[model samples]
Target chain A: MLKFSKSHEWVKEDAAIATIGITDYAQKQLGDIVFIELPQPGAKLQKSEQLGTIESTKTASELYVPLSGEIVEVNSDLVDNPQWINESPYDKGWLVKLKITNHSELNSLMDESTYRELIAKESH
Target chain B: MESRKTPLYQKHLQNKGRIIDFAGWALPLDYGSMLKEAKQVRLNCGLFDASHMGEIEIKGKGAFKFLQKLTPNDISLIAPGQMQYNLFLNTSGGIIDDFMCYYCDESLLCVVNSSNKDKVVSWLRDNKEQGVELIDKSEETALISIQGPSSSRVIARVFGEKIASLDYMFFTKKEIDHRQVLISRSGYTGEDGFEIYIESKDAPYFWDRLIQEGEGFGLISCGLGSRDILRIEAGYPLYGHEINEETNPYEASLGWAVKSNKDFIAKEEIVGIKNKGLKKIRVGFIMDEKALARQGYGLYLGRNKIGEVCSGTFSPNLNKFIGMAYVLSEYAATGKTIEIQIRKKFYKAKIAKYPFVKINTKSKKEV
Candidate 1:
């Protein structure tokens, strides 16, 4: 199951590791993803802080850290192939791998159902 | 997604244009790959649906006098059939919009961006004095642009050899799509191109005919995505990015377009700004790295922040990052060292000459 933040980031957890990327809604709003500046490995992050940046033809946006964690790895392939984020945002588009800083913070995020509802509301 | 169709929307769709909404108007950014479309226009020829943009006809006896007061440029210098690229200014000397004014007989056709249609129309309508009538022909008219190195050959093939004889900034009336049409030798991309104006009903036929006939000459239907990269490479100004209500024309490096001889809207303020000397100027930069420097990215001179990138893109032609920014006047000269902050990391860049690539053309012909 995917957990989502209000800012449109999605995260999937497996034991102690979490994989994260922006939601489909975010990609659609971005139109076409031209470049993405991913966070560096070993960088520490706070909840809701800007983690990286994404650019499209018309605009650019800051990707937010959904929860506090230390980045264990980043999807370096995106540096050369940024369109992967737009193509497979949920799976192969996983932006970063994080070592969870606070386990309880994950509970604050919305599950798939709740996240879908939020997107529906945001569109209106 | 909600798509806003222009007057020539169906025509663009029929011409095999990959349609997309640009600033609420359903327009073709390109018919195919943007890079190939751009190159085709540069090497051979390409046609574009520019009808999504707005065109207002200001006629009546006082049309010229009214425009002189409405625009920042001197309208008196523009003779019949001549056109000039100019800007509209607010009271504070900020750019209201960038536009091209066409002098057609007693009427002047002002072509503007799609997003600024209502705003520009309202501005002109509000300022219309006695003996001047402002007509919004945007919905009734359609525009198409055929551009590239082989543009003359393509135009001569369709509209006749007379089109090849048109001088820069001049337009002529010709028959296209079975209707009387206006063809002008002007374009946004720094290339030899022709802009055709015709009735909306015949736009679809005109677009299809041009694409079908120009296929051998490498004509491609281009979209907004590629257009952005091309214009950015050519170092032209986009309204919201490069020139806006907060930025003055002089600072945007449009001081050459401003006429000092006559008094127009915000002329005194512009003259005052000129006397104080321009504090900042728009300059082009090419990045050394493959990374793109997007709009609002802070530009740095060593460690000090000097300016910010207004527009940037990955030039498909040059296969590198190119951009424009407004740096401090002292660092505005070509070849100055500058750095852009992309994702909080500074990347090295250098201020370069305008038109990242120079387009060669033989345009000695007059209209």
Candidate 2:
């Protein structure tokens, strides 16, 4: 199942583990990604809480967790080559892999179609 | 209150520009990506709609004399058809605004910051002399800047050979597409370019024509986002960030604009401050970490709170985070290490000389 947070982070769930990254719209809005401060593996996070920071040429934005979980893995490649987020946000730009603790927290996030509609409304 | 839109608002909307509220004006933050636009300005050419900037005309028999008294720079340094970077100082020797004063023979044209337009007008009016007339031309005037290394080639292609001979800080009046405009060889990007001032009504058409003609020359439309980054890379100071009513010219490293011999506003205080030397001074620094240092972030030398960042950005050219801060004079030397407290964590940084990227303009020697 694929879900997105209001803050523009997307999560792709496989079994109880989910991979998290910013949406294409979010990367586009942020411009060229220069630096990203990611939470380390084993770090605990709450739903909608600031998990990390993403810095672009213009501004810096806080990255929010879509669901409450413990970080299983982080994309360490982003530290030296942050532009991967801009070049291939969906694939190589995955920020973290989290082992979801609360399955009910997933209900709060919007599904793919709903997130598309939200972004559509926002663009207008 | 609703923000006023520039005449090119529709064009920006059509070009996929992300509109944002900037100093009570609706302006594009960028057309696509600020990083791309900033790179384009450095490598090729970029078009900028600077219509939101304010222009005030001071005309009369005592126009030159009144300007001499108003600005910190020596007004006599620039002749007709030339412009000089100047500062408007308050009674307390603080910066009111930094402007470009254009000497147009009979009248002096003052190009000021959009955010400080109303305040500048009021201040000028209050200090009005008997013969000088202060007229706000901001609403009627529109400014368009074509900036980059290839800017001269693009401008020469459209406007003709006349612009080719125009040196930096020089301006000339010309008619383009049946509209009379003032073309000045000046820009904020620290690049070779031209700033064209035209009537607001002619702006849309002129913008379209430039974009259409400049397409062959690889000129792309840029926005304020890239402009800010470009200026920061060039080590140029913005009004509210590097200077304000509380910050004096000496501390801002703008002492060159103040003519010590001239009898201007806050002359004695400014001269005294210059003689006494600055306690704190503005310096550029590069962060050791990839994380960005932002404005208002505190700068510290160990545990001592020395100063704070004024302007900060991730430089596209340098591929590093660089920023300007007003630090204690003792720690202002190049290569000095400092720490910037960003989001509760202190990041190591070093004071460095700027322009972080080498300036490649036609008048590089002059700068």
Candidate 3:
């Protein structure tokens, strides 16, 4: 199942492991990702805490964790070529894989349908 | 406060430009990808709507004399049809605004930053003497710029052979689409480009016509995001970032615009500041880490904060993080090591000379 945070990060949960990345809407808003600082594997993260940082040509933004977890795997490819985040934010651009420790925290995040509606309202 | 829209606001929306409130004006932050737009200006061509910029006209018998007393540059040196970059300074040698002055024989045109329009106009009017008339033409005029290596060809296609031969820093009045307009060979991007000043009503038409004709040459619409990056790469300073009412031209490395022999506002003070040397000077740097340094970020040597960054970005062309900062004179030398505090981390960096990207501007003088 897919879930999203109000801050624009998306996650896909397969059992206890969740794959995460920024949404397409967030990538479009950021405009041309040049660099991304990804959290290292084994780092413990709290729900809604800063996970990493993403930089475009003009500005930089902090990436936030959607749920409390420990980073299991990080996409190191982004360090050399961050444009993948802009080209394929959901698939090839997945930032990290996390071992979910607080399963109830997922309840606070929006589902795909709710996230779509939120973006639609933001555009208006 | 509500933000005012420019004449091309609708067109920007039509093109899917990301609009943002910039200094009371609703302008495009980017038209899709800001990096792509910035690269277009470096390799191909980019079009920009600069209508938000303010234009002030000074005329009458004492117009020339009045301007000589207004700006720090030697305005008398520029003949009619020539333009000079200048700074409007306060009595203490601080810059109020940096502007371009165009000499039109009978009158002078001053192009200033959009945010400083009211402040500049009021300053000019307050200092107005007998025989000088000041007219604000910002609302009635629209400014457009075609910038890049291919800009000359694009402009030549729309105008004529005359535009191809124009020298840098010179302008001429021409009739385009049956309306009188001022075309100048200058731009904020450190590329060979032309700035077109026309009637506000004709802006939409003018922009559309250029895009249509320049399509063959790869001309694309750019926004403020790309504009900022290009200027930063070129070592050009923005008003609020690199200069302000408290920042003097000397500290900003704009001493060339101040003529020591000329008598103008803050002449005595500025001359003294020059002789005393700058306490802090602006310098460019490339961060060793991947992180981008931003304005107001502290610059440090060990634990001591020496200065602060004014403008910064991840350079698209250089493929690295670069920025400009005002640091103490002792730490302003090329290759001088420094650190920038981004968030809680301090990234290693080194001072370097500006124009981080090589400038490709045309330097041919008119015979």
Candidate 4:
């Protein structure tokens, strides 16, 4: 199941492997994403840690890791083509794959239904 | 903080504008594509609702003389219906606000940024001479800018031969579309354009008509987003970014605007600073790479941090990142090599002359 963070990061996990990317709400606010700084594979990250940076035409924002993990692989394709995040944020724009080190962190994240409500509230 | 709205707020919504709070005003940032809006202005004409900017009316016997003491530029030579770009300076010789002063008979009109409206009003009220009366007319007036290469055609259609005869920095009142309006041949973009000031009640209709009549010429309803890009490409400085309370007009490369003979407010201090020579000065730069040099980004000479970027953008017209920054006067010379630290990576850049885009304008009146 996919869980979301208040900062608009999303992580989908099953067993101990997880895939992460920012939510649609994030991409919209960033506006015309021009550049993305991605983390390298094998980098260790803590829960709520800074992973990389994303810059749009108007502003720049830091992408944060939702849960503690070791990155197994990264979307290097995004380095050359950053617009993928604006085109398909959730499916094809997945930022990183990680070996989950802290499964308990997932319990604190909002589920799909709850995340939709959060987005609705924040949209206003 | 509550966002401020203009008299034409509903009109913006009807045109599908994307609104954002800027300097306390809930202004339209863009309609959709800011790049398209910018190109529309450069290629054709674009109309902008700038009613939120503050307008101050100063009149009476001491009006022009009082302004001589309040601002950095000389206003004594400005004739009626003429406007001059000037700056308000604090006692420390730092810029309080950059504004346009319009000579209207014995009275003068000063237009300032919306964010600094209250502060400017209070300053005028406190420093007002006994014979001068100051009035805040921002609420009663509406400001609109018709800017671009095709702007002359648009204005000619509206005001006929009257607009054609209007000289740059000059204004005249005429009846247009069944309403009395004041039109000035002045603009922020480096293009031939006109700024219209009309009654508050007639704002919506005037805005709608211009947008409609301008449709054939690719007239767009531009917002703040395109305004910034256009101004930056022209190498004009925004108040807070390039000229602030902490930065003086000398450092802003506005020394030419300052009068040596006229004794305006902070004249002594500014003169003293000029004699000593300015340490830091604003300069234009183009990125050696595709990366941007945003506000507050560290400007470097090799590994040493020299200054910070004041305003930056990826100019759609140029298709490259261009910007302005304050560097030590030694590095302010043209062709000086510099580096901007963007997102922890250094991007190579070089100092270039301002107004990267040369505007071909028709102006008979000299500054």
What DockQ does each prediction reach against the true complex? Answer: 0.18, 0.79, 0.77, 0.29
Instruction: Record all residue pairs in model 3 with backbone atoms less than 3 Å apart, i.e. clashing.
Output: none
TM-score of each model, paired residue for residue: 0.78, 0.96, 0.97, 0.87
- The Cα RMSD in angstroms, rounded to one decimal, for candidate 1 relative to the true structure is 5.2
Model 4: per-residue Cα lDDT over B27-128, one tens digit each = 888876576788788889888989988999999999888888898788876778889989888999988888999898768999999878889999898898
Model 2 misplacement above 4 A: B364-367
- Cα deviation of B8, candidate 3, in Å: 0.8
> Pairs clashing in candidate 4?
none
Q: On residues B1-367, what C-alpha lDDT tens digit does candidate 1 reach at each position?
A: 7876766676667766767677887777665446566666677777777787899889999888888886778777778988888889988898889999998986999999888989998988878799999899888888888878778777887888887778888898866546989999888787888899988888877777787778888887777777777788778899999999999888887887898887788888888988998888899999987678878899998789899899888776786778999899898888877889886578899999888888553443322
Q: Return the clash pairs for model 1, or none.
A: B29-B222, B29-B223, B29-B224, B30-B222, B30-B223, B31-B221, B167-B366, B167-B367
Q: Tens digits of per-residue lDDT for model 3 on B148-223? A: 9999898988888797668899999988779878999989888999999999998998899899989999999999
C-alpha positional error of residue B233 in candidate 2 after TM-score superposition, expressed in Å: 0.6
Give the Cα lDDT of each candidate.
0.82, 0.90, 0.91, 0.86
Say which prediction, candidate 1 or candidate 2, comes out ahead on TM-score: 2
Q: Would you list the clashing residue pairs of candidate 2?
A: none
In the range B138-228, model 2's lDDT, one tens digit per residue, is 9999999999988888888778888756999899988877998999988998888899999999999889888988898889999999999
> Candidate 2 residues A26-97, lDDT tens each?
998888788889888999998888898898876789998989999999999989889899888999998999
Instruction: Please provide the root mean square deviation of candidate 4 (C-alpha atoms, Å).
Output: 3.3
Ranking of all predicted structures according to TM-score, beginning with the best and ending with the worst: 3, 2, 4, 1
Output the lDDT of residue B207, model 4: 84
